[model samples]
Target: MGRAIVATAALSALLAVCGCTVQGTDADGKHHLPVRIELPGAKASPSATASTPGTPSAAPAANVLWSRGDSGSGVRELQARLRQADWLFDGPTGTYDDLTEQAVAGFQGKRGLPKTGETDKVTWQRLVKMTHEPGKWDLYLMGGQPAGAPDPRCLTGRVLCIDKTTRTLRWMIDGRTVSTMSVRFGAQYTPTRDGVFHVYWKARNWVSTLYNSPMPYAMFFSGGQAVHYSYDFSARGYAGGSHGCVNVRDEAAIASLFAQVRTGDKVVVHR
Candidate 1:
């Protein structure tokens, strides 16, 4: 009886071991115990989430800074900025000539700024904030005695008026009325003298012997008064401004006028 009990006990132990199945499969179609593995983020390891397709990446914003000075590059940059702001002047050539000075003064005056010809940090900042808006100004002509009819000397040409109120300059050209930038004039003592004259001559890189002023693309309209590039205080477009001269603040514009105008071209200046 004891021998039979021992054999039965051994057989029961073998059956229990055989009935315990493992999770893995083998080449012989037999199961085996699997190797233990701890999942990521299961208190054993850390992992990041994978990125998906069609996800947009954020872009950086534009960063703009203001600058100033008379360096060639800086001047060019300022000119470009002014042009972009619809200041329709000339390209910066690094020469702080009369035209550039005039344009700068005009720009400052239009913005209610102090009419200093020099550009400063505030000017740079203001220029950056400027926008391209169409400008208009009211002008008056003051030449020749007033009669019921147009004076014979009053040749068929347009008079340009620079309006201080609106900061714009308007004129008639080629039978078409047009407007441009606004500028300052001289004070009562040296107001832009009224006259009826003709473009008698043109001088590129012109130098004024009377005032020792250098005029770029000077177009003679009166005796000593001609339309030329200047940066004098007259850019304010006030009264009694010039020393018998019509000052323009844009060199490119003067160049344009030089290209189109000829001797005997009539110019009428009014109040």
Candidate 2:
């Protein structure tokens, strides 16, 4: 029994040196010693590896400065700059509309931008770099200038009080200004006659048989001179002059004025 104990102790010491542990006797009545092996410098398994925090991400969208349906002096400034670039042709109307949206998109596309039709910060910066600051008349190139005081001849009755110097037209009733807009007159050679007249005729959607051009919302005050909405005037703003009639650039304003005006309304065209 002493010798058997000595052998078992020797086996135990050997097993411990080998990093082995005896689990239990197998079916063969032999002790099963499983050795736990460890590598010198092995990498950790995927499951045993420690987890790390995720990396940060950038913003999903760019910063927007202006977009469709936005309006104010900012929009006017934008439009005026766009006009300088020849990307826009209408009023700085101080109201962002479809035309403004299209203009912005076109400008963005020309600059290799995302062309989202929204004026983003980067896009605005690029535009500012390419264009200069707009002047006062540039902002009001297509009208919206302040109207002048009504003449004494226009105060008493319903009158289309037009001031050549101010380049404005005021619709007045009983000495009260009802509505006002910007107006352009004929060229130097064919100047708009300054006189007190009456609207003798009105023709909606009229094509001038003499000039072969469209004269929408025409209110004839003289023989062939009328107050009318001119698409040319709207598109080219003060860059060109009319033949003999008064040209209105704002079509909507002129349309509204056309609806209110009637035959025999006083028309005072003055300097």
Relative to the unseen true structure, what is the C-alpha lDDT of residue 71 in candidate 2, on a scale of 0 to 100?
88
For 171-224, candidate 2 gives per-residue lDDT tens digits of 999999998989989999988999999999999999898899999999999889
lDDT of 1 by residue, 6-87 (tens): 9977865665455432255689978775423444344422222222367532442222222233445456456555655656
Positional deviation of residue 166's Cα in model 2 after best superposition, in angstroms? 4.3
- Count of backbone clashes for each model? 20, 0
